[model samples]
Target chain A: AQSVTQLDSQVPVFEEAPVELRCNYSSSVSVYLFWYVQYPNQGLQLLLKYLSGSTLVESINGFEAEFNKSQTSFHLRKPSVHISDTAEYFCAVTLYNQGGKLIFGQGTELSVKP
Target chain B: DVKVTQSSRYLVKRTGEKVFLECVQDMDHENMFWYRQDPGLGLRLIYFSYDVKMKEKGDIPEGYSVSREKKERFSLILESASTNQTSMYLCASSLTGTLNTEAFFGQGTRLTVV
Candidate 1:
């Protein structure tokens, strides 16, 4: 079985400040990792994903996450955040053979204050 | 762009009532998933369908059932609604055979059990 753990329940940062959300996973087999962002009253949107290429993956919105196999971590980072970036982020993992069932973390609420 | 649509944005139902939530994706993806999102728990998978008439249980599948009679439609059914089952329901779809492919989600349906 695979599970994901998001270390931070909430992270508050001022506008233009950098932010990082920690995520760790436990999987016995090789897995695929993903980051998703959910705004208020909306569903989740894909942020980035790490499949089999370089360890680091980036999203178009200036967000990046690196897949560290040794540490079993895929932490998300943004150089700067805006008030509009305030949302909930979730990290998910699925086994390489699993069809499409993703195990998600507890989520980290990012509040970007103006 | 892929589009996933949920039946409702907000729903109010009494305890013990039968509830059904519908989802439709226009991308013709072979995989569809149902998940429930809570405040702190993030998104927990309830069930998923790989193809029409083929359903599989996910992490949390108690008290919930799903039906996929058509290729583009998936429905989540609550045999008997309970207070604990009240949460934001999300539907997502993705192409088959690609573990790294992104899943597109609907706007979500928020259900409140009274």
Candidate 2:
């Protein structure tokens, strides 16, 4: 079994400011990490994922997340946020042997203010 | 691109009524999932199916049941709708195999139980 924990429940940042959303997971076996963004009244969209190879993964919209195995963390980051970036972000983990059943965190609401 | 479609965008139901939420995937993915999203809680998995006629309980499956009769369609059932079950429901599908697989989500169905 795998569990994901997103530390921040809300993150308020000004436009053009860099922000980081912390996430940690606990699992005895190998797992896959993912970040998803949900806009108001919509479902979630994949932002990035960390499976193998590089520990760092990036999205096309300037969002990135680093998978730290030692710390059991996969934190999402963005260099500069825009007003449109305001949304709820979720951190998830899937166990290797569970046939890809995802467990998500409580979510962090990112409010990018103008 | 993978597309997951939910049956409704918004639904209003009364308590004790039976409710069914439908989901269909166009990608022919082998795995389908049903999850509920709440305000404080990000997303909690209710049920999942890896193949037709195969279903598994997820983290929060007590109040929900699922059916996967065909390959492309999955349904989530609430035997007796309750006020607590009023939340956003999301359906997702993914390919089966590795832990790194990404799941595509639908636009979500907001169910309001009164």
Candidate 3:
């Protein structure tokens, strides 16, 4: 069975500080990776995804994740986070032909203090 | 953008009461999911429907049931609400075939079982 693991349960960082949310997955076959974010008083949204082709995937809000096949990791990173970036991040994976069922990690809460 | 809407943002129910959480997606997505979000558990899927009248059990579906009479709507039912079932319930929708398609989520419903 496939599973996801997020390294940090909570990360407190100052504004403009760089942040990294580590994620690791266990799967024998190829899979799609995703990062979803839930801001305060808001719904969850897709931050980025890794399907194929490139090893790196980026979201519009300056967040990027690199797919490391050998390490089975897809960690999300932001060079300079803002106060508005405080949110809960979830790492998820779906099998290639599994019809879009996602297996999620334990989540990481990122708190950016101003 | 896809819009996934849940029936309630907050609900309080007594123990042994029957509870229902409703979800609707405007994008006519083929897949709709119900997930329960806890502090350290991220989001655990309770049930998912791929098409009308088709439902599948997810990771934590033991205490829940689902209904999908139409393509855009999915409902999660708790036969008997309990204190342990109090959590944030989230609904999500997505397309089926495309491997890179992302799931869009609704603002969660915070259910409190008293």
Candidate 4:
């Protein structure tokens, strides 16, 4: 069985400050990694993903994550965040087989204050 | 761009009532999923369908059922709604392949059981 663990439950940062949300996963075989974000009262949206090749994947909103195979971690980071970036972020992993099932981490709430 | 659409943005139902949550995807995706999001719990999979009439139970399928009579539509059903089942429900669809695939999510349905 695959599982995801988000180290931080909540992270508070000021506007324009850098932030990182830690995520770790446990899987026996090859897995696909993804980061999804949800704003207030909104559905989850894909932030970025690491399927193959590049270990570092980035989103258009300045958010990036590095897939460390040795550590089984894919931490999301942003050099600077805006108030609009305040949201709940979830890390997920799925196997490399068809009909793959996604296992998600306990989301980290990023609260950006002015 | 792939589009996943949930029938309701918000729903209120009484306890023991039968609730149906419909999801339709514009793309011809072979995989469809139902997930529930709760505070601190992230997203928990309720059910998934890889093809028409082929459903699989996810981690939290206790009080939920699903139907996939067509390729583009997936429906989640609550036989008897309970207060604990009140949460944000999300629908997602993805390609059948394991590699280079990403799930597209709907806007979600907020269900409140009173």
Q: What is the C-alpha DockQ of each candidate?
A: 0.68, 0.67, 0.65, 0.64
Per residue, candidate 4 scores C-alpha lDDT tens digits across A1-114 of 889999999999999999999999998998899999989888788899988898999999899999999999999999999999999999999888644367899999999999
Candidate 4 Cα outliers beyond 4 Å, as residue runs: none
- The residue pairs found clashing in candidate 3 are none
RMSD of 1: 1.1
Could you tell me how far off, in angstroms, the CA of residue A54 lies in candidate 2 after the best superposition? Answer: 0.9
lDDT of 3 by residue, B27-100 (tens): 97899999899999889999988889999899899889999998989999999999999999999988888565
Highest DockQ model number:
1
- Model 3, total clashes: 0
Query: Interface RMSD values for the candidates, listed in order?
Result: 1.7, 1.6, 1.6, 1.7
lDDT of 1 at A72: 97
Model no. 1, DockQ? 0.68
What would the per-residue lDDT of candidate 1 be over residues A1-114, giving only the tens digit for each residue?
A: 889999999999999999999999998999999999999888999889888989989899899999999999999999999999999999998876555578899999999998
TM-score of chain B of each: 0.97, 0.97, 0.97, 0.98
Put down candidate 2 lDDT per residue, A36-78, tens digits, no spaces.
9999888899999888899989999999999999999999999
Off by over 4 Å in 1: A97-99
2 or 3, greater by TM-score: 3
Fnat of model 4, as a fraction:
0.57
Q: What is residue B24's positional error in candidate 1, in angstroms?
A: 0.3
Per-residue CA lDDT of model 3 for A1-114, tens digit only, reads 899999999999999999999999999889999999999877888899999999999999999999999999999999999999999999999987555578999999999998
Q: lDDT of each prediction vs. the true structure?
A: 0.92, 0.92, 0.92, 0.92
